[model samples]
Structures are given as structure tokens and as C-alpha cells.
Target chain A: MRVGLDVGGTKTDAVIIDDDVHILARTRLATGWGVDAVGATIARAVDLVCGEAGIAREDIRSVGVGMPGQVAPGSTRVAHAVNLGVRELDVTRTLEPILGIPVRVENDVKAAALGAHALHGSGSGTMAYLNLGTGVAAGIVVEGQVWRGAGGSAGEVGHISIDPAGPPCRCGQRGCIEALAGGGAVAERWGRPGALPVRDVFDAADAGDALAVALRDDLARGVASAIRVLVLTADVDTVVIGGGLSALGDRLTTPVAAELEAGAEASAFIRSLRLRERATLLPAGSPAAALGAALVGRTTEEVLAHG
Target chain B: MRVGLDVGGTKTDAVIIDDDVHILARTRLATGWGVDAVGATIARAVDLVCGEAGIAREDIRSVGVGMPGQVAPGSTRVAHAVNLGVRELDVTRTLEPILGIPVRVENDVKAAALGAHALHGSGSGTMAYLNLGTGVAAGIVVEGQVWRGAGGSAGEVGHISIDPAGPPCRCGQRGCIEALAGGGAVAERWGRPGALPVRDVFDAADAGDALAVALRDDLARGVASAIRVLVLTADVDTVVIGGGLSALGDRLTTPVAAELEAGAEASAFIRSLRLRERATLLPAGSPAAALGAALVGRTTEEVLAHG
Candidate 1:
């Protein structure tokens, strides 16, 4: 069995999968902040998940971790995971000796992208997993491998400015896709004190609130622009929307589709691309990130041998 | 010796190269309009270039032709070559039987991208060849292979709209990168008669013409955005500016560098990218496109065996 863990800001999701990736057991635990605590949380989560599966630690072949931070290509070190309050952490060094198994770490978004590909990929071509979370970002998977570009920033489409006059991005750009569509950006712009501000904004838009309507429209526009950029730049076969905002489901996809439809109606080239048909939403509560981490643990040499 | 032909709208540039891709001989011929003439032109150009190199046709290993049309991935067929008045043409079928040499065709921009990579690639990572001809387009190369995305529309950054309220494009979008920076678009917007209107616009801008200054700024803005998009999305190590507009050399790159510098000044993240350092201009009259086509004709099997 292989083990995978999604180390998020508030929670660590763990899963044990068999050879065919069938989940043997799954569990979740509150994630701790900082390097030491997060490391401890991972250790505890692995123990709990192994217990849940009624398996000995020796039965686990390898462990893979999906972290919400910068995982450099080909390295287990994660850096600047602000949401988790982690300045830096070398996951392999911390976990390998304790677990007595091979370990690998990948960025959460990229891990999810790999999982999404395994779950829903067409078995060929490319798919971009666009994360519309606290800040928008994406991960491109081509032929089952994550496209980690030269500087390990291949899918940073959120910073691409579509509007020079729309809104200022935290990245110091005006009218970035994130400024228009990010969950945190939307919540901040809505300026309402609510745990689910984006959901609230959507609810208010349905009631014909002009401000909410505009905000919702911008969200759709930003998402549609991201889809276009992905298709035009990377020419990914599909863009699977998966993030905190995607939990809204049809409420989110419908408007984003409308925006794509509008662009199609305006341009024959855009129409030919059929962006609306290509954009899709990941199912709510999917364990893609965790599942992908397990796959990551298999190591490059093992994958080559097995496949 | 390998033969490469760059079949453009008005001229066909042909070159003969040795095993190391060094140019041994080069020649040019006026391209004829339509299918038959274009096919004939390719045959004649190859023969002439071979003769110029003092070699027999049998001495040539393969021939590659670059066309200004859509060459579907892994196909030798060229379609919708409006610039050359060709609606459709299977370049290989037309020439292979006549010349008795293996023939391959690729889009001009894509061919140029490969050539640029061979000429200036860092020997690792990725590079984007941004073409600023009558229209703006780019072709990305990773390692040594072209990144032909799923639908083969990868690197069509020209049509991506940066300003919703900017100038209208022939593709029915407003504020497209092409609309702002394309030679054709700038010429139309400038509305003055000249063989080289973009050059005139620069000259006028230098003389403090208000309209020219605005046009120049827009051009820089469009190019800068393209560079940013290439870096942010693909994380290419460098972007080489080529095509007709690059003939302006420092006149064009200077303003483009300034725009990147200004963006870096505004955003610390942008500064971190060091975009100004990454964007570069291809040398004038470089034989990259033809050389790339020659390389392309070597075929997939050949590349695997040789590399």
C-alpha cells in the first residue's frame, strides 16, 4: 500500500491506496502551524491512517505529501507556505527516518492536477487544473506528468493581467485574473464580514444587488479569461476548475460559461476553440490532492519500471 | 547536406546546411501564388540551393519547408495559407515524388522557434520565440522539441485581449496583443501610406508626434505583456523576439525593456521575474526559420537515433 497526505492550512487529509489506487482507508486531522508542528501533524496523521486501515507501518511502500507551499521541482523542500505559517520545511529529511519508507513531496495544486488527470484525464493530451482559491493559480499536466517549467512557475496564469484598469492585484498588477476571481480577493472586495463571503456574494447577486452582480460578473470574466489564456497559451485539452470557489458548482460554472459563450459569439476564433465546452468543475469533496500525493511517492524509477 | 525552405508570402528563402546545421549555400526566389506554383517554387528553390552548394540532389538527406499557414501537428499539409493565396496544400505529397527526398512542413513561426532554440537556446530549460510580423504569434521550445499543445494552438498569444476597451482586432477581439503591436494593425491604425509604416511611426514618435507616441507606447505594452505571459505561464528561461518587427532592433527593444522595467518598478513579484533580462531580439536576417525546417525534415525516427 502507498500513503498520501494533503497538508493544507487547517487540515491534513490522509489516504492509503492499494496497487490499483483503490483507497483502503482515509482520515483527516487538524493541521498544525509552523515547521515543527506541521511535521508532527504529518507523523500523527500517517499513524492514524495506518491504524484505520488495520495495517502495520512496515506494509506501507512509500509516502507522498501534497503541501500548500512552494515545492521546488525534484526537491522535497517546501518554502513560504504562508497560509500554513511555514517558512521552510524539508519533508523527506523529517519523515523518512521516522517512517522507514521512501517519501516525496509536491505542491498541493500540482498534486491535485496529477490526481485530476488520473481521475478524469482523457488518457492523452493535456489538462490544466485551475485553482480559484484564496488566490487563483493553475497546474498543467501533460501526458500524466506535471509540466514543471524552467523556474518551477509554469502555471502562474493568475498574475497575467487581462484588464489594465480592472483591479489591483496583491502581486502589484492591475486587473489580474486573481484580482477578479480569487476567493480572498472577492471576499476582500465584497467587504462583508462573513465566513463564506463568496457564497454570500453569489446569493446577493441572485437577488439583483448591483454591487454583487458586478462582482459576480467580474468573477466569471476572470475565469473565462483564464480558460482562454490556458487554451491559447498551453492549448490544454481541458481546464478542470478545482478550488475553494469551485464548491459553488453550477452557480460558478454557469456564469463562467456565459462569459465564454459571449466571447465565442463575438469572435469566430474563440468560437472555434469552444472554451465553454472545455471548462469543467471538479466534484466537491474530491480527494484528488491526497490521491495524487500517493502516486508521487512511487518515485520516478518505480513508475518507469511498472509502466 | 539538408535542404530547408522558408516559403513566405512574396519570397521563398532556401538554404543548404551540413550535418552541424551550418549554412553552406543560400538562395531566394519569388513565391508563386496558389497550390501548383507554390509546390513548383519549393522544388525550384531546393534545386537552386543545392546547385549553389555544388552538390547533387542525391547528396541531400532530407528537405524541410516552413509555410505561413496552419500545419497540423505531425502533418505535412499546410492549410489556409492566405498570405501565399493557398487554400490547402500537402507539401510533402507534392514535392516528395518529384524530388525523391523526404519532405516535412511546419508553420513558419514554429520553425523559427526551433531555429532560434538551436541558435540561442541555453542548452536546457525552455525558450519562447515571439514573432512580431504582420500579426503577433509565438512558438515555445522545451529542451529541443517544440511544445505543440493538444489543439496545436499553443502560443497564440496575439489574440489574447489585454484591454477590453482597446482597438478592435480582425479576430473580433478588442485590445488584442496583435491589435496593439502587429505590423498590419499598427499600419492600419497609423493610416499613413508607407512601405514601412511601423518604422515611420517610430520616426514620428522620435520627432514628438502625439499619435505616434501613443502607438509606440501601445506597441511596447503589447510586446511587454506577451513577454510576461510567456514567463508567467510557461516559465521559459528566455523569450527571443523575431519576425519583421524585430528588424527595428534597439529601436523596438529599448521601449520594450522600458515597459518591463516600469512593470518591475510597480510589482516586486514582476521585479523578481527579471523580465527585462529575459526578453531579447533576434538578429536581423538570421536564417533560423530555414535552418529549423531543415532540422525538422530529419524526421522523428532520425532525431531519436541521432540524439
Candidate 2:
């Protein structure tokens, strides 16, 4: 059995999977501050899964973790995680010896992409996966391998500048797609005077609120623009949209699909090709990051064997 | 020995290299319309190089050509080239027989990235090569391999939407980066009344014309925005600027570097990372696309050997 864990800003989600890719058990708990507490929370979730499944700890062969931040290969240290307020935390060292199993960690978006890719059965094709949650980002998979650029930062679709003078981005650029259309931006635009969660903004949009509708459309445009960028740049045939915002459903996908079609026709090279869109509206029931992390471990093994 | 050829909108350039990587011979000629004429022009250039270097056609080894459109592997059949006014032209079938050698073709921008990666030695790391010429596009190189997404369309930076409602792009989007910053757009903006080329605008900017200065600044901002996108999305350590517009020199690079520095510190993920700015100026000696094409042939050899 393989154990998968997803550590988000607010919650730690865990799942256990068998060789056939069936979920054996799952658990969730609030994510605590500090690296040690977070590690303990994850451990509790794992233990709960094992207990619920009536299996001993030894039955779990490998543990995979997905978190929001930079992950170095063959190490558990999270190079940096901005939202979680953690940096350089040795997750493998802290969790492995305690859990008595080999552990692996990966960036959450990359894990999500793997999960989405696996779900769609398009593992052989190049896939671009975008998650529009607190922040917008992408994990690009080309022929089953994640295209991490020089510093493991290749799939940063959020930072692609959409406007040279539109709005100031958190990254200090003017008019990045993330700055204009991410969940935080949407909430800030449509939420009440007090800072409301992004969910409420979607609720308002669904309820036919004008401001909310406009905000949603704006967000859709951002999504479409991102898809265009992906299509034109990566020439990936399939695009998977996931994250909290995807719950808006057709409001996001319909417009994004249209935009992608339009962008493809604009480029001579793209015009001859057709692009396909896939929906990842819900987080995979399994801890995708964890599974992907496990896959990473397996890939490392293969590489080592070949070398 | 390797040969690189770049076929631009106005000109065709060829460079022949010795095994020691020294330029053995070079030639340039105007590009002609129709597949046959273009093939003949290329053949003439290859023959000139072989004759000058006292080499047989067989000793020439491999040939690489960069054109302005999509290309298939192991063949020179350009799938689509809007600027070149050709579709599915079997360039390899037409040229290889004439030259009696192996030939490889790639998208001009991808070839430029390959060339920049090899010539400047900056591409040894994660590198993003942006070409600002008749059209703007990017080529991403990671770990010495070009990252071509699903359909070989991975670096169309020009089509990344900047405005959903700003201006109509040829791709049917409103306010794509290409619509705003491509050389055609610059020429259109500066052409007013006389319809001068973009080069005239750059010359005017150098001569301290007010309108030219404004246009130059706008162009700089556009370039800066692309750089921001490159840094944020790719986390590339080096950016190689090429294409005809780069001929503007410091009038472009100085402002772009400043803007990138200002923007990098704004992101938590980017803040801790050091972004290095390499030479904005490429070697004026060789056309980047042609050099890149030669490297593409070399890459094809590597891929064939490994396969």
C-alpha cells in the first residue's frame, strides 16, 4: 500500500492506496503552524488511515507528500512555502524515521497535475494543469515528466504577464494573470468590505449578483488567456483545470475553451492543430500529490537503475 | 562539421562550422517565394560553403534550417508557415536530394534558443530565449533539452493575452502580447502617414525624437513584461534576447533589467532567489535562427543515437 498526503494552507489531507489504485482509507485535519506540528498532524492522519484499514504500519511501503512550495529531489526539506510560513523544513527527516517508511515530497501543483493526468488517462500526452485556488499556478507534464525549469519553476503560468500596465502583481509586475484573476483577487473584488473568503464570491456570482458576474467573467478571461498561452507556447493538446475556483463550472471552462480556440487560430503553427480541454473541477479523491510523490520516487529508482 | 541556416522574412543566412566549432564559411541571400525557389537558394548557399572549405558534400555531415513555422521531426515538411506562405512543403525531400546530406528543420524561435544556448553558453543552465523580430516568441531550454509541449507549440509567448478587451489579435483574442509589441505593431504605430519600417523608429529613438522615445519606452515595457513572465513562470537563471528588435541595444536591455529587478523582489518565491541578467547583446556575427537550426541537427543526432 502507498500512503499519500496533501498539505494545504488550512488542512492536511491523507489517503492510502493499494497497487490497483483503489483508495483504502482517507483522513483530514487542520494544518497547524510550525514544521513539527504540521509533521505530527500528517502522522496522525496516516496512523488513522492505517487504523481504519486494520493494517499494520509495515504494510505501507512508501509515503508521498504534496505541499505548496519548492521541493528538492531526494530530500524532505521544503525549500520555501510562502502561504504555510515554512522554509527549509526537513520533512523527510522529521517524518520518515517517525513513520518508519520511506517518504517523498513534491510541489502541490505538480502532484495535482499528476493526479489529474492519471485520472484522465492521458499520461502519454503532454498536459498542462492549472490550479486556481488562493493563487493561480500550473504544473506542466510533457510525456509523463514534469518540466521543472532551471530552478524548479517552469510551470508558473500565474506570473505570465497579461498586461504590461494593467495592475500591480504580487510579483511586482503590472497585470499578471494571477494578480488580476486568482481567487484572492476575485474575492477582493467581489467580497464585502470585510475580507470574505473566495467561496462567498462564487456564491454571489451564482446568485446572479452583477458585480460577482463581472468578477467571474474577468476571472474567466484570465483563465482563457492562460489557456491561450499554454496552447501557443506548449502546444499541449489537453488542458486540465482544477482547484477551488473550478467549482464555478461552465462559467470558467466555456469561456476558456473559446479563448483557447481563438488563440490557436491566431498562430500559424497552432492553426493546423486542434486542442482538447479536460475538466478537473474537483480535487482528486486521492491525495494526488502523495501519489505523484510516490511516482517520483519510482522514477528516481528507474533512473538510478539505468545509470 | 555542422551547418545552420535561418530563413527570415526578408533574408536567408547560412553558416558552416568546423568540428572545432570555428566558422568555416558563411553566406547570405534574399529568401524567395515558393518551395522550389527557397530550396534552390539553400542549395546554392550549401554548395558555396563546401567549395570554399574544400570539403565534399558527404563530409558536410548534417544540416539544420530554421524557418518561420511548425516543423515535423526527421522531415522538413513545414506543417504551417503563414509568413512563408507555405503549407506542408516537404523541405527535406526538396533540399536533401540536392545537397546529398541529412537535413533537419525546426521553428525559427526554437532554433534561436538552441543557438543562444550553445553560442552564449548561458543556456547550459535553465534559459529562456525571447526573440523580438517580425513576431515575438520564446524558446525554453532546460537541462540542455528544448521543452516542446504536446504538439511542438511550447514557446508562443507572443499570444499570451495581455488584455481580454483591449485590442483584436490576429488570433481573435483581445490584447495579446503579439498584438501590442510585435515588430509589425511597432511599425504600424510609427508608420503614421509615411508607413516607415520599425527600424526607422529605432533610429529615430536613437536620434532623440520625442515620439520615437515614447515608442521605445513602450517597447521596453513590453520586453520587460515578457522578462517578468519568464522569471516568474520559468525561474530561468538567464534570458537571451535576440531578433531584429534587439538591435535597439541598451535602449531595450537597460530598462528591461531594471524592471525585472523591481518585479522579482515582489514575489515571496522569487524574492529569495537571485535572478541574473546576462548579456542582452548577442554576437552580431551570426543570425541566431540559423545557428539554432544547426544545433537542432546536432540534437536530432543525439536523439537518434539514444533511441
Candidate 3:
């Protein structure tokens, strides 16, 4: 058996899976802030999940935690997980002795990518999980293994500038994909307070508000560009869109598809790619992140060097 | 000994290498039009290179050919090699019987990427070869193996639109990296007849021509965008610029480096990536394409699957 945890900014999701990857138990808890609190939260969640699974802690073979941050390749230390309010944390050191299990850590988007591939991929090709969260990023999985690039910055597509005149990005560029499509960027551009700012923007666009309509279009354009980048650069078989904004479902995917179709209409090269058919939305509330964490915990080596 | 051939639009470069990858002999010949002529061209090049090496053709273990076209994964058939005046050709069918040796085919840019990594890469890290040819494209090599993406369009970064409002591309897109920096596109934009139109544009820009200045800056911008795309999407350890236009050397790399530096100035995030340091220029007349072809010929399996 293996245990997995998705330590999010607001919540911690836990799962217990058997050898065949069957989910034996699942639980969620509100996440706490900072290092020690976060560690304690993981411990509590682990215990709760074990109880829910009706198994002793000794039954678990390994634990994996996925979070929004930089997890160095082949290491359990996470850094700059701003969303989780974690500056630095050694996940193995924090949880291994307490749980008496081997521990591994991976970036949340990467873990989700692995899990999504397991659930939705063709089982024999490359897939990119494009996360549209507070910041935009992607995680690529090839043949079921997450691509852990040099310096661990692979799939930082959010910073690729698509337009010189588009918009100012917080990353100091103009017209970054994240600047246009990220949930936080859109909310800031909308200048409106709402629990679901992206959903509100979509609703206002439906009502024919000019700015809302423009933001909505920009979101679609950014997403379409990201799809093109993923296909052209990595040539993944499909792009699975997930993240907070994905909750909009068809409201988001429809326009993004339209944007790709529009580009295809103008360019025969783009038309031939049949990009629209290759993009799909990850079902909302999928346990991909935690499930992927469990899978990751089982890998002996996440890095490969070819001679 | 292994034989490698770069069957270009105008010239066919051939090389013979020993088991240690040491070049034994190198020769070039004018390529012919049509399928039969191309087949004859390869045979002639092989004979000529073997003579140059003072070795018999029977000693050759395998022959790998790299050309501009679409090569399906693990296949020796090439499609849409327009510059070579061939719509479709099965290289293995045409050459194997003639040579009595195993023949492997690969895209020129992809071959060059593998070759460049072998020559200039850190050997164990990922690298991208950005080919600034008549059209812009990139080939990514990870751990010394070319990343042949699903469906074999893995490195077609030329069509990625970096500026929607900047310029129209032959691919029917606006502001594609190719449209801005491609040798063909820039010459078309310049509308001047010159053997080396890109170099002419650079020289004219140095002479203070307004149109030339704009075109030159666009080339730099396009190249910079391509480097960024490679780094951000694939996180290549370095981007080695090659292809026909790379002959401009410092006139090309200097401005491209400046463009990357300019982006770093605007964003601390860009600064952290050290993109300028990662961008490099392949040496003039480097045998990367043919060498990479030779390397590809030796691989028993270019594909992998994980479960």
C-alpha cells in the first residue's frame, strides 16, 4: 500500500492506494500555514486516511506529497512553495520518522500530470497537463514518466511571451500566457472582488460587457497559444487542461477550442495539426494530484541520463 | 565504419566515421532533382566519401541520411521535402538495395540537434538545436537522444506565433518565429535579390537603412523568442543555433544575446533563467547533421514505452 498527499494552499488531500493503484481511502483537511503546521497537517491527514482505510500505519510502504513549489529532481526538499506558505521544507525529514515510511516529493502540476496520464492518457504516448491556477504552468509526461528537466524548470510556458502589445506580466514581460490566462492575473485585470473571479468574468462576458468579453477572449487566446506551444515544442499527444479555472468546464474549453479553430482557419499548417481535437479538459475534482503522488512515491529514480 | 549523409536542397554532404565517431572522410556533391536522381545522388556521395576515406564500401556497417522533411517515428520514409523537389520518398527502399547496408533516415534539424548535443552539450543534459534556416525549427535532444515527439512534429517551433500583430507568415500565421527570422521570410520581406539576403539585410542595417534596421531587429526578436520558447517549454540546458542563416555568426548571435539580455532586464524571473548564457551558435560548417544521422542509425530502438 502507498499513501499520497496533495498539500494545497487551502486544503490538504490524502489518499491511500493498494498495489494495483485502487484507492482504498481518501480524505481532505484544511491546510495550515508555515513549515511546522504544514508538517503536522500532513501527519494528521496520513493518520486520518489510514483510519479511513482500516489499515495500520505499518501497512503503508511509502508516502508522496505533491505541492505547488520547486521540488528538486530526486530529492524530497521543496522550496518557494508560495501558495502553501512554505519557504522551504524537507518533506522526507519532516514526515519519514513520524510515519515510518519512505517519502518522496514532487511538484503538484507534475504529479497531477502523471496521475492524469494514468487515468486519461493513451498509455503509450506523451501528454502535457497544463495547469491554469493562480499562475500558469505545464507538466509533461512521456511514456508515463514525468519530465524533470534540467534545473527543474521544464514546462514554465507561462512566461513565454505571445504578444508584444498584449499585457504587462508580473514576471516583467509583456503579454505572457500567465498574464493573460492565469486566474490571479485575470482577477487583477477584472478589478472585481469575487470568490470565483474567472467564472464571474465568463458570466459578465456572456452579458456582453466589453472588458469582460475582452478578458475572456484573452484567456482563450492565451490558452490556445499554450496548446500550440505544447504541441509544437513537446509534441504531446494531448493537452489536458486543469487547475482552478478549469472548473468553468465547457465555458473555458469551448472558447479555447474556438481560438485554436480560428488559428487553423488562417494557417494551413495549424489546420493540419487538428489541435482542437487534441485538447480536453480534466474532469473537475479529479484525484489526479494525490493519486500521482502515490505513483511517484513508488519510482526508484525520477531522473534518467542517456549516454 | 558508419556512413552519414546530409542530403540538402542544393548539396549533399557525406561523411564516414569510425566506431569512435572520428571522421574518416568528408565530401560534398550537388544534389539532383526527382526520386531516381536523389537515390543516385546518395549512391554517388557514398562512393565518393568511401574513396576519400580510402576504404571499401563493404566495410560500412550502416548508412544514415538526414534531410529536410517529415520522417515518421522509426520509419525511413520522408514526406513533404519540398526543397529537395521530392513530395515523398522512401529512403530505405531506394538506398538499401543499392548499398547492401542498413539505411536510416531522420529529419535534418533533428539530426543536427543530436549532433550538436554530442559536440557541444554537457553530454548528460538536455539541449535544443534551433535551426535558423530558410524556415525556423528546433530539435530537442535529451540525454543525447533526439526527442522524437508523438507524430514526429516534435520540433516544429517555427510556426509558433510569438507576435500576432507583427508579420504574416507563409504558414498562414501572423508573427511566427519563422516569419520574423526565417531566411526565406526575411528575404521575402526585404524584397531584394541577393545570394545572401539575410547578410545583406544586416549590412544594409549597418548602413542605416530604415527597412533593413526593422528587419534585423525582427530577426533578433524572433531568435530570442525561439530561445525563450525552448528554455521555457523543454527547459533545454542550451540552445545551439545552426542552419544556413547561422553563418552570420556574431552578427546573428550577438544581437540574439542582446535581445535575451533585454528581457532579463525587465523581469527578475527572466534574469534568473540566465537565458543568454544558454544560447549558443553552432560553428560554421559543423558536421552535426550527418554525424547525428550516423548516431541515429546505430540506435536499435528510437521509441520507448512505460507502464
Candidate 4:
């Protein structure tokens, strides 16, 4: 049996999977501040899942962890994760001694991409998974492996400057896709007198609110522009959109696909080649990061054994 | 000994190197229309170099050719090169058969990056090479390997949208770095009645022409914005500026450095990290693309053999 744990800003989820890849048990818990509290929460979740699965602690071969941060090789020490309020936390040391199993750590978005890939094996080709939630980020899978650039900073689709002089991004750049189209940006643009939540903004747009409609279209354009850049740079066949805002469904996918079609026709080189447009929308499951993390551990072990 | 050949828009260049990597001989010829003419020209250049080095053709271990287009793996088939007005040209089949030597073909910009890596070797850690010439493109090298994203379409940095609503780009996009900051853009902007060549714009800027100064600063801003995006995506230690336009030394580098520094300060996360600021403003020698192409063959062979 293997365990997957996804740690997010609000919650931590754990899933126990048997050898046949069936989900045996699952548990969720609120995440707390500080490394020790987070570690305790994860350990408790793991224990709960293992008990529910009717498995002893030793039966759990390995644990995989996913979080928002830069991870070092073969270690759980996060190099940097600004939103998570943690830096250089020795996750492996904190969790491994308590859990009594080998652990692996990876970037949360990367884990999600892996999960998405596992669900649709066709994504083994050059695939990009974009997350448009509180922030916009991407995890690129190239040839069935994550293409982490130097220092694990690849697939930062959010930071690609779409507007040189537009709104400032959290990354300190001007007019990044994130600054203009992320969930926060959508809320800021549509949250009028009542300060509507991001999800409600989409609902209002569906109800024909002019401001919300415009905001939705603008977000779609941003997503489309990002897709165009990805195509031009990676020449990937599939693009999977996940994260909080993607729940809007057709409100996001239709316009984004139309934009891509328009942009492709604009370039002769792009026009010469036929591109396979994979699913524009996909649900990365609520505990996708944790599942992806567990899969990472499983795959890493497989690769190491075979390699 | 290795040979480097650059097949450019107007001309083809070839350089021969000895075991010690010293340049032995160089040849230049017009790049004719058909593949046969181009192949013959390359063969003649190789013969001339071998004669100059007083070595038999068999002694030349490998040949590298750089073309202005997309290259397939293990072959010199030009997938698409708009500048050369050629598509799907079988360069390796044509040239290797004629020259009776092994040939490797790569994108010109990638070759230039390899050349820059070989010559300067300053940014040996994690480096990027941005070529601001007739067109603006970039080649990213991470840990001494060219990062060919999913397919061979990884380093089309020029196409990243800078302005979604700005001027139309050659790639059919609007407000790409190429549309605003490439050599053609500069020429079009300043090539008014009685206006000098694009090279003279730099001279005029040096002479304190206000219009020229503004143009130079704008170019720097554009390049700086691209650099900022690169930093966020790649987290490289250094960036090397090459191509015909990089001759504008500090006029371009200083402002770009300043802009990036200002951008770094906009976010606490960006500021907290130790961002490397090593920038090289140097032009590769004439025929750098060809030399870089040759180096590609040598490097790839070494990598394959070792792996």
C-alpha cells in the first residue's frame, strides 16, 4: 500500500491506495501554521487512512507529499514557498520519523499534472496542466517526465509577461497572465459593491451581468494567450486546464479555444501543422495533489528499480 | 577537428577548427535557392578548410550546420524556416552525402547560444542566450544541455506576447518582443526619409539624438521585460545578449539591469532570493551560427556516447 498527501494553504488531504491502485481510504484535516503542526496534521491523516484501510503501519511502503514550494532532490526541505508561509522546512525529517515509511516530496502543481496524466494516459506526450486558482501556475509534462527547468522553475506560464505595462503581478512583473486573469484578478475585477467571491463572479456572468461577462471574456483571452505561447514554445499536443476557476466550464473553455483557433490561423508556421486539441477542461479532483504525490512515489520507485 | 557551418538568409559560412580548437580556415559563400546548390557550397567550404589545415577530409570528425528553421532529430530536415524561404529541406541527406561527413543541423539561434556558451563560458552555471537580430529569439541552456521543451520548439522566446493589442508580429501575434524590438522593428521605426541604416541608429544614439536615445531605451525596456520573464521561468544565473543588435553595449545592458533590479524589488519573494545579475553583452564572431552548429554535433555525440 502507498500513501499520498497534498498540503495546501487551507487543508491537507491523505489517500491510501492498495497495490492495485484502488483507493483504500482517505482523510482530510485543516492545516495549521508552522512546520510541526502541519507535520502532525499529515501524520494523523495518514494514521487515520491506514486504520480505515485495515493496514498496519509497516504495510505502508512509502508516502508521497505535495506542497506549493521548491523541493530539493531526494529531500523534503522546501527551498521556497511564499504563499505557504514556510521556508526550508525539513518535511522529510519532520514526517518520516513519525510515519515510519520512506517519503517523497514534489511541487503540488507538478503532482497534479502527474495525476491528470495518469487519468488520461494520452497526456504522456508533451502536455501542460494550468492551474487558475488563487494564482495561475503550470506544470509541464514532457515525454512522460516533468520538465523542471534549472532550479525547478520551469512551466511558470503565469509569469509570462502578456502586458509589459499593465497591472502588476505578484511576481513583480507587469501584466503577467496571473495579474490579469487569475482567480484573484477575476474577483478584483468583478467584485463590485458587495465583494463577490470568484465563483460567484462566474455565476453572475452566467446570469448575464455585463461586468461579469466582460471579466469572464477577459480571463478567457488571457488563458487563450497563454495557450498560444505554450503551443509556440512547447508544441505540445494537449493542454489540460485545472484548478479552482476552471470549474466555470464552458464559460472558460469555449472562448479560450476560439482564441487559440484565431491565433493559430494568424501564423503560417502554426497553420501548416495540425494540432490535436485535447480536453480544454478537466477536474483535478479535490485531493489531486495528494494523489499525484503518491503516484510520484510509486513512479519514482518504479523508475529507480527499472533504471 | 570540427567544422561549423551557418546557413543564413543571404550567405553560408564555414569554419574549421583543429584539435586545440583554434580556427584553421573560414569560407563564405552565397546561399543559393535550391538544396543542391547549398549542399555544393557547403562541400566546397569544407574542402577549402581541409586543404588549409593540410588534413584529409576523413580526419574531420564531425560537421555542424545551423539553419534558420526547425530541425528534426538525427537529421538535417528543415521543418520550417520562413526566413530561408524553405520548408522540409533534407539538409543532412543532401549535405552528408555530398561532403561524405557526418552532419548535425540545429536552429540558428540555438547554435548561437551554444557558440556563446563555448566562447564566453562565463554563464556556465544556468544560462540563457537572447539573440536580438533580424528576429528576436532565445536559447536556454540548463546544466550544459539545450532545453528542447517537449518537441524541438522550446526556445521561441520572441513570440511570447508582450502586448496582446499592439502591432502585428511576423508570427501573426500582436505585441511580441520580435514585433517591437527586433532589427526589422528598429529599421521600420527609424527608416524615415533620409534616415540612415539601423546600425546608424546606434551611432545616432551615441551622438545624443533624442529620438535615437528613446528608441535605444525602449529596446532596453523590451529586452529587460523579456529577461524578467526569463528569470521567473528559468531562474538562470546569467543571461548573454548576442545577435547584431547587442553591439549597443551598455546603452542596452545598463537599463535592462536597472529595470530587472526594480522588478525584483516589487515582490518580497523576488527580493528575498539572491538573483544572479551576470549579464554578458558580447557579439559572437561572424559565422558564429555555423561554428555553433558544428559544436552541437560534437556535444550531442559526446552526450549520447556517455549516456
- Top-lDDT structure, candidate number: 1
lDDT computed for candidate 1 = 0.90
Q: What CAPRI-style quality would you assign to candidate 2?
A: acceptable
Q: Write the per-residue lDDT of candidate 4 for residues B1-307, one digit (tens) a residue.
A: 8888887777888888765556778877787665556667667777876786687889888888788777765556776676666766777787777777887778888887776666654433567777888778778775445656555656566776677666677777677777767888777777654433456776788899987776666676668755655655555556778877776666567767776677667756555433425566766355556666767766655634431
Model 1 chain A weakest lDDT span, ten residues long: A298-307
lDDT of 1 by residue, B1-307 (tens): 8998899888898999887768899998999988899999999999999989999999998999999989999997999999998999999898999999999999999998888887887755499999999999999987677888888889999999999999999999899999999999999999999999999999999999999999999999999999999988888899999999999999999999999999999899889898998888899988888888888756556544543
Tell me the deviation in Å of residue B198 in model 4: 2.8
At residue A256, what lDDT does model 3 achieve?
A: 94
Candidate 3 iRMS, in Å? Answer: 0.9
User: In order, how many clashes per candidate?
Assistant: 0, 6, 0, 4
Q: Tens digits of per-residue lDDT for model 3 on B37-60?
A: 888999899999999999998999
Could you tell me how far off, in angstroms, the CA of residue B59 lies in candidate 1 after the best superposition?
2.2
Q: What are the lDDT figures for the candidates, one per model?
A: 0.90, 0.69, 0.89, 0.70
**Highest DockQ model number:** 1
Write the number of the candidate with greater DockQ, choosing between 1 and 3.
1
Question: For model 1 chain B, where is the 10-residue window of minimal lDDT?
Answer: B298-307
What CAPRI class is candidate 1? high
Candidate 1 Cα outliers beyond 4 Å, as residue runs: A297-307, B297-307
Give one digit per residue, the lDDT tens place, for model 1 in A1-307.
8899999888999999887778899999999988899989989989999999999999999889999888988997999999989899999999999888888899999998888777777644599999989988899987677888888778999999999999899999899999999999899999989999999999999999999999999999999999999989988999999988989999999999889999999999989998888888999988888988888845456544442
Q: In model 1, how large is the Cα lDDT of residue A217?
A: 99
